[model samples]
Target: MTMGFNESQSAFAAALLDPGLPLPQGITTARGVTDPLRFAVYRNNVYVGLTTALGQRFPVTKRLVGSEFFAGMARTYAADHKPATPLIIHYGDDFPDFIAAFPPAASLAYLPDVARIEVAWTRAYHAADRLPLDVAKIAAVPPERIAEMSLVPHPSAGLVRSDFPAGTIWSAHQGEAVAPVTEWRAEAVLVVRPAMHVEIRFLPPGDAAFAACLLEGTTLGTAAQKAFAAAPDFDFGSALIGLVGLGAFSAFEAFEGKLP
Candidate 1:
């Protein structure tokens, strides 16, 4: 059957990741004959390239699972989740979700969150550059009006709240020798690239709740209230200053009336 150029291109692309699919019609070597062996080699190379890309994107995840196991799992993921765009960097946006649902990775409950952290790191690295909210401007606001203001998170600011020590695990993997994670507990991580470098910070006490509320456009007072509810010892002052120091906000909005 005759196929249009676009149709052939689509078929060829699909078959690259899916080895079960037959070679696209009209595909042949320079010798003018279809060679199944050559096509198999090409298919294998495509899977290898994509698996390598996933490995690079999720190095800690790869290290957590041995190279052999990761390669097998990555190949399976690439086969089902083909690239939506031509840009390789954008290929694995859904990988964290994939790892979460993948049966082999079910035993490692925290693996998904770790992948999410890696995903955030890559996104922050590529995010558009913007000037962070100036600390001085925040300090200048009248104390009475502070509660009604909403701080705008930077474009690269992302939160990863996990029930396990995902941030600690991720941080431990950054060094040459993996450090043991003695404390096993929930962790709320802030991933942001305010300037040249992407920074990862573990939020303390009620800071996560406060940051989450602020990111959702809630007023500072409301957010502080929520944080206090989450942590009895929540200090609104320290939390505000710390987040500003990390450059988590790009701008802020002030309301004339009292904010709930």
Candidate 2:
């Protein structure tokens, strides 16, 4: 009897995973060589391709774990979770979860958050393009109505809050300016791509709250109130200026059907 396609495919998959297994019947060997040796090359290539793709996605995580350890983790992760899509860029969505449950990485509680930040960075890099708000337009808003104004956050804007100092840790590894510190602290981060570049910045509690409110479609006055509530010394003017500097604000629209 002829083998069904599903059975044949299952055998092929098993053979790829286990080099000891022989290729399915009716599969021809190349150059009259043994099927096992030919299949071994294919299996090795599969591992190498997947490992390379994962490393490219999580370079920071790979660097943190070291080459050998990263390769091992990638192998296990790939075995457990095959890529659902053919796009390599979107291959590692489950990596953070995998790392969180990985036994060897249990000692490093912050590794998962680091993976999340890396994923966010990649997503921001591929987000749709948009022009940042013009500072002059924001400045032209009347002082009286400034509080009633609402600003749109860019499409790529995202906030990440973590108990660990993931933002600081990620920043330290980015080859940017660093400060001497021996202790870890809780952190909140804002990620956005205003023009074409993805930028990540550590945010203070109040600023993070304010940005969250704005991203949630709250009015400027309401968000400022929340920010002040979070941090009594929160500076509205400074926050506004900082957003402008970061290109966080896409455009300004008034609360009452008016345009800034």
Off by over 4 Å in 1: 254-260
- What TM-score against the true fold does each predicted structure earn? 0.91, 0.76
Could you tell me which 10 consecutive residues in candidate 1 have the lowest summed lDDT? 251-260
Question: Which pairs, if any, clash in model 2?
Answer: none
Residue-wise lDDT of candidate 2 within 73-146, one digit each (tens)?
99888876766788878888889999999999999998889888888888778877888888888778889898
Q: Which tens-of-lDDT digit does each residue in 111-202 have in candidate 1? A: 99999999999999998899998888888888988988998889999999999999999999997899999999999999999999999999
lDDT of each: 0.91, 0.83
Name the candidate that leads on TM-score.
Answer: 1
True-structure RMSD, every candidate:
2.8, 4.1
Alpha carbon lDDT at 66, candidate 1: 88
Alpha carbon lDDT of residue 199, candidate 2?
A: 94
